[model samples]
Every structure is written in C-alpha cells, then in structure tokens.
Target: MSAGPFKVCMLGDFGVGKTSLVSRFVRSTFSDKYMTTVGVKVDSKEVARPGRDPTKLVLWDIAGRNAIDSVSANYLRGASALLIVADGTREASLAAALNLLMQARGLLPNAFAVLAINKFDLLDRWEIAPPTLTQLRRAMTVFETSAAAGSGVEEAFAAIVAGLDP
Candidate 1:
C-alpha cells in the first residue's frame, strides 16, 4: 500500500545542531564542526511501522541562520510536520527555538510540530533547569536527544510520523 509522501521541516537557531541532527538521523554520521545548511536539503526515507505500510518521509533539512524570523515563511512550504530543535547546552537558544515555533505556527498552523532538545550528551555542561523544560512542554511535544550519540533520534522521528498519522 502507498503511504505518505509527508514533508517534514527542521527548524532552529544557528549553531543549534539542526543540520547535525538531520545528518545523524538520515546519514548516520556526526561531525564536531558546524556546517550551515544553505536553502534546504531534501532527503527521503521509507519507514516501516508495525501495523502500517511503509511511509515515505520527505525530510527537509532547512538551514539554520541568525535571522530565523526573516526566513521563516520561505522555508516552511508544503510541510506536513516540523522538528524544532534546540541546543540544550545553550539554554538561551531554547527560547529562540520557541519563538521560531510561534512563527512557524503562524505559517503552518495545522502542521505537526515537535520540540526536540538536542545535544543531550552535553547535558552535564548545560545550564537548562528543570523548570525551563516544564515551561517548554506547554507549547508542544518535547524530547531530549543527542545527535552525536544517536539518542532518541529514531524515536523522535517515529513519534512525529505517528503524530502525523494520528
């Protein structure tokens, strides 16, 4: 059976490891250096879930930039879901990611959005407090992940797929 052709967008502030997360998930590779994504890179993968036909996900790894507000409308076209990633090691960017979410909501009001706290491996060095995480939950589905270690990467994608189907 044919399943979606769903379009998923990755959004966040510059240097939040949005590209790294996508690279890890799709390509199974990690890099210590920060390489900015230009425009957008699209990758497709067919995922099989237990009770459903394989779904074709069109993953759009959008570029992270300093001026997220200016490019918000341009990058979110035809998106079925969004993964809003934040660098957990930098607590300040979490708010920036949330603001991006608000902007994204304005653009794609009905699209499914997931709040991913990336770089969990750096938690020991992070300043993010427990209450900040609680505050984040008020907006969307939140997950802690490490692109470097591959923690919660697949599950985050799977959850997004399930949310989209539901």
Candidate 2:
C-alpha cells in the first residue's frame, strides 16, 4: 500500500446504516439512535495486512442521497475506493446503491468499489430475493453485514482494504 492514506467514500441511500457501520468498525461500538448525516462525517482507521505495512483508510460518510448532485459529487472527489451500502430490508435501497455506484464510477472509473448489503440482522424482513443477491455476488464483491450485530462489519472493511491498490 502507498504511504499516504487512502480515501474511501461511503455511498448509499438514506437509512442504509453507513454511519452505523463506520461507528462499529472505527470505535467498536453501535447505537440505536438515528442521526441524519448533514454533509459528510470523516473517520480514520489503520488496518494491518500480512507481509505489508499497515495502511490507513480515511472514511468519508456522505449524507444519503437517492440521486447524485453537485454537492454529492464534490464529496466523492479524490476517493480511492467506494463502499456502496444498501438496506437489505428495503429493496429500493439496492437500486439507489446501484445508481450511486454508476455515478461514482463515472467520476472515478478506476476507483475500487465494494457492495455492502447492510442490516442483515433484519434479514427476515428483507425484500431482496435470494436470486438477486446471488446475482449481485456474482457481479461484484458483496458482503452481508449487520452493523448492529457486528456481523461481517470487520470483514467488509478488510475486504475494501484488500481490494485497494497495494
């Protein structure tokens, strides 16, 4: 990995648990209270890789937006990777996540990206079908995560780090 920290932008629809995932990974904590992100919340974590120096990741938790805008595009500037999150319980959020991915790719075609189907703890209520999830996994690196339960949270971050340029 490079000496400088990599900037990772979180892209997803509203209430997709992007903030919760960041909190869980960075602070080893989660909260039930819901707080809307105003602009962007920044956090950092250093992850270790075997046989290589530790790499620092600067996480940018952008406010949820169904569509891309000037403000959102500005937030994605200089991103090295994208952690596209979607709410598993709400299938529409998946569509939103895909849209966000397209926009992000348009801006940063070479940036590494990963999908995180969040809220796995609420899988019983998920509207996304099994076939769709299987298709998604075939298309990209996908992680079923539940920030509330801490399931797959660390693995998701680790996957992002592993996928980045070394």
Candidate 3:
C-alpha cells in the first residue's frame, strides 16, 4: 500500500528453507537440493493488500545459520519487516528461528515480523510437538508452510506487506 517498495528480511536457521520460501513466493519455484545462502539473495514481488493498493516487497533472503552473526548487518540495514523461519522436521531449528527474531527486532524495533515453520510437505516427519507450536504462536505470528507444495507461502508474504501502512 501507498505504492512504495518495502524491504523484508528472511532470517532463519541453516537449511530451514528460507531460500526455498523466497523462490516459491517470488519466482513460483522450489528446489529440492540444499543450498546454503552465502550472504543474502535479494528478490522482489509485488503483492496486493486487502482494501488497499499493491506494494513491492524486496525480500532479503539472509544467510541462515544457528546464530545471527551469519547474517550481515548490511543486509538488514533497511529492512522494514522480518520473516523468521524454522525447519518443521528439525525442532532445534525452531529455537534458532526465535533467536533470529529477537535479533531482528532488536535491530529494527518497529518492523513487523513473522515466525514461519517450513517443510510442511514433510508432515509425516514433523518433529515439532504441539506444545512447541503453541509456544511459538504465543511468541509471534506463526505460519506452517510447505515451499514444495506452495502452501501458505503466498499468505506469509502478503501478511508482511499488509502490515505496512497504506
């Protein structure tokens, strides 16, 4: 809305599918091969907001790691929002995602943020217990996404855009 470009950073644990989610949302593609992001891969997609105009989201796919240092501050310099992701099949990644969320909020206190639990296509192997999900939900706006199936990916991105003022 307001017809302006907004930067949104994707922060999460390594192999949590941050790149895949970005690919799916921006390019409508998903790759099975695991590729660790070196620094940040920027991508853009325009999303329409409910009862408002569209906005261009410059998605900053920050390098994922167990710690926030893996993400260069340069990449977060102008971010307007955050998408903190976790691997559903790996419970530990959830912790890392929360850590990244805290770091992002600390750096950009006024920015909107989302907690995404990725790899939903692998539902059979999901290791995140219900209690954890509840806890995560209380912590942030949580989404269960499957980049491989294109489920919830669009909504996740659109939600961030909608959070911006019109």
Candidate 4:
C-alpha cells in the first residue's frame, strides 16, 4: 500500500483529552484550557517510517459524543485508523472509549485502532485496573499517555502509523 494521507478518527467521551492529545502529537504543544470540539476539527501530521516515505495522517478530532449517532458516523467516513482515548481518572470514560471503538469498528472494519488512556501524569487519581489493561492489550495496542506531560504521545501516533503499514 502507498504511504497515504490516511484519515484517522479520534474518538472518545467528553473531557478525555482528544484535542490535547492531538495538539501534543501534531504541534508538540499542550494547553490546560478545555475547549469542546464543535462538529469536527481536522489536523494533519506526517509520520516517518524506516526505509519508506513518510505517511501523512489526516486526523479528524470528532466531538466527544459517547454514542456513535448518524452525524458522528458521517464524520468517521473514510477513516483508515482510529485513536480512541479515555481519561485515566475516569473509569466510565474507558468503558465509553471501548464502546466507541466497537461502533467505529462496525463502521470501518479494516481501520487500524489504538487505545490511549490519557492523563498518565495523574496516576494517583487513576482508576483503571491492571487486569483491565491486560484485557485491552489482548485486543489492541494500549498506551498510557499524558498530553500535559507529553508522554507516550508520539509513540501512540507512530504505533498507529506502523499498524497501517502493509
């Protein structure tokens, strides 16, 4: 397959830091201010692969609607990958992320999916259990990320790009 400007949809519940994750990965910047994504926000980043041309990932940061309704499904159209995020401080958000992943898979069966449990910096307040992480690992590549601290941000993006390699 060609090194494409692949469409990667970012899905999660509200306040999961989808925007922050994207900002940190794409622009190497993070902000404390919370801004709800209206409709969808589009951003692009070129990821380097060894011995191949860089892959351009066109990231679609979708609004944090827990359910995949008609409007959300439309925004996810043509996606080749997904970055499903969840707030580590909120266990319910993790469940929501998983559900969103399921819905996204139903829509785009072949799209590469990666799970990111954000806010790793706040480990003290983390609620996700080890067994849960282990279970998730059996399904998809899981990364603990901190958008504020810029941890695992690049690796998560790179892993998705690598997964897209054919």
Candidate 5:
C-alpha cells in the first residue's frame, strides 16, 4: 500500500489537554502540566491501516480557543482532517469542543473530523452528561482517550488516519 500524507488539526478549549493528547499520541508521553499553546504546534506520525496503505499524519495542535468565534480559521485551511478534543471531567470543555468542531468544520467543509474526549482515565470524576456524549458521538467518530494512562490514544489517531481516504 502506498503511503499518503495528511494534515490533521487538533481543536479544543484551553486546558482540555490538547497538547498532552498530541504528545501522548506522537511521542508516547504525557505530562500533568497545564501549559498554553500559542499558535499551532505540529507533530508527525506514520500510521498503518488494516487493508489500506500507511498514512503520514501531520498533526497540527492548534491553540485552544476561548470561544469558537475567536479561532483563527486560517490555521485550519489546509487540514485534511480534524481531532476535536474535550476534557471528560469538565462539562464546559465538551461544550467548547462541540462548538469548536462546528466552527472548524464550517471553515474547512471538506475535512473529516474525530471527536476525542480526553482524560478518560478520570471517568470516575467525569462531569459531562450522557446527553453530551450522545451529541458528540452522533456528530462524528468519538474516542475516549487518556493521555496519562495511554488508553485509546492510538485508536483515536488510527481512526483519523483510516478516515483520510481520498
């Protein structure tokens, strides 16, 4: 199978673990620190799909949006796909994630998106409602990921790569 290169942008709210998620998926590492991403941080990973060729995912971890309206749409212009992340323990993050997804999709109508609700390892303290999960799932391919515990991260990344078909 021939390898294809795709640019995938990561979207979410501040402190929703966007950086950590990318770090975990790309470097197999995680940190509990809360550092802000200024503009866009790019990382690369080669993913193998089951019946298809490997894909080179150029993940662009965009800066967390204060609101969907404030996002720089230009940052998402060339993206082939998206990974909208949310924090499971913060209900507002999920709301923000949805809003971000909506706005980003509108900007790049052709880009495929995956909803990633991060910090799933803290499900015991999760504050998001069932209806919220239902909404996100209905919206796109959703993944419950934990960068700290390294759960569901690979699947989420793989899901994005598998979806990058021409």
Candidate 6:
C-alpha cells in the first residue's frame, strides 16, 4: 500500500558528513572525501514495513555553515522530521548543529529530531570524549553512526521514520 509523503531535513555544521549519511541511507554508498552541499538536495525513498503501508520519505540535505537567514528558514518549512548531525570528532561542530536546530525549532516544534553522531568509525581518535554522548542524549534521541561503514545508518533513518507523525 502507498503512504503519504513525509519531508525530513538534515541540519549540521560543515564537514559533519550529513551528505554522506544521506547517500549511505538512500543509495547504500559512502565516500570519505568531503563535498559541500549547495542550497539543498532532495531525495525520495520508500521505507517498507510489515503489515503497513510503505512510507515515502523525502530527504532534504541542506547546505552546511551557510547563513541562517530567512532563506534557511524557508528551507525548513513543512519538514516532518529533522536529523541534526554532528561530527563525533568535533564538539564545536555539535554546538553549531544545536544552534541550527534552535533556529528551526520555532518553525518545526513538533518535528521529530534525531541526533546522529556521525563518523563513529573514528571513535578511537575522536577529540570529543564520551561525556559529550551523555550530554547529547539529554537533548534528543542519539545514535552513534558511521556512514562510511554503513553501521547504524539504516537503523538511524528508521528510528527517525518511526518518530514521524503518521
């Protein structure tokens, strides 16, 4: 059966691997090189479930580190969910990601948010210590993910989908 389309937005700091996470989830692929996302990139995929209609998720990967002016607010309009991604190696980037979330919270207060700590594969050498994980969890649902290895990527997306309003 068909399901209604849902919009999901990805917000984070530069080089936080938001694009890589989306690519890994939607295309099942990953790349190490960093590429800046311009304006916004939209991708649609159907999420299958047992005994229920498949949900259509329209993923929006917005540009990182861009000005959070009126234009950025426009991009967040009508988003059903938000994936606030941050580099596990950089605590500052996580703070920046939180700021972005705060900016859109007014517009999407009910929007489900999943805090994805990207690049879990680099956990051994991460600058951000374990304490940060505890702090992040207090804010939202936190997932330690490695897009490069495809670990917890699909599960994270599924968790966000489960949180979305039906």
RMSD for each model, in Å, please? Answer: 2.0, 1.0, 1.6, 0.8, 2.1, 2.1
Please report the candidate that would top TM-score against the real structure.
4
TM-score of each: 0.92, 0.97, 0.93, 0.98, 0.91, 0.92
Q: Report the poorest 10 consecutive residues by lDDT, candidate 5.
A: 66-75
lDDT of 1 by residue, 8-119 (tens): 9988887888888878888899999977778888888777777887788888888875335556577788888999988888887788888888888888998899988988
Once model 2 is optimally superposed onto the true structure by TM-score, how far is the C-alpha of residue 14 displaced, in angstroms? 0.7
Model 3 segments beyond 4 Å from truth?
none
TM-score of 2: 0.97
lDDT tens per residue, model 6, 63-143: 986236777789889888899888888878878878888877888888889888889999886777778789878868889
- Segments in model 5 whose C-alpha atoms lie over 4 Å from true places: 1-3, 68-71
What C-alpha lDDT, on a 0 to 100 scale, does residue 116 get in candidate 5?
86
For 1-166, candidate 2 gives per-residue lDDT tens digits of 4664999999999899999999999998999899999999999999987677888999999999988899999999999999999999999999999999998899999889999999999989999888998999888989999999999998988888888854
Task: Give the lowest summed-lDDT range of ten residues in model 2.
Answer: 1-10
- The per-model lDDT (C-alpha) reads 0.83, 0.92, 0.85, 0.94, 0.84, 0.85
**How much lDDT does candidate 2 score?**
0.92
Better of 1 and 3 by lDDT: 3
Which of candidates 2 and 3 is the stronger one according to TM-score?
2
lDDT of 1 at 109: 92
How are the candidates ranked when ordered by TM-score, highest leading? 4, 2, 3, 6, 1, 5
- Candidate 1 deviation (Cα RMSD): 2.0
Error of 3 at 34 (Å): 1.0
**lDDT at position 95, candidate 3:** 85
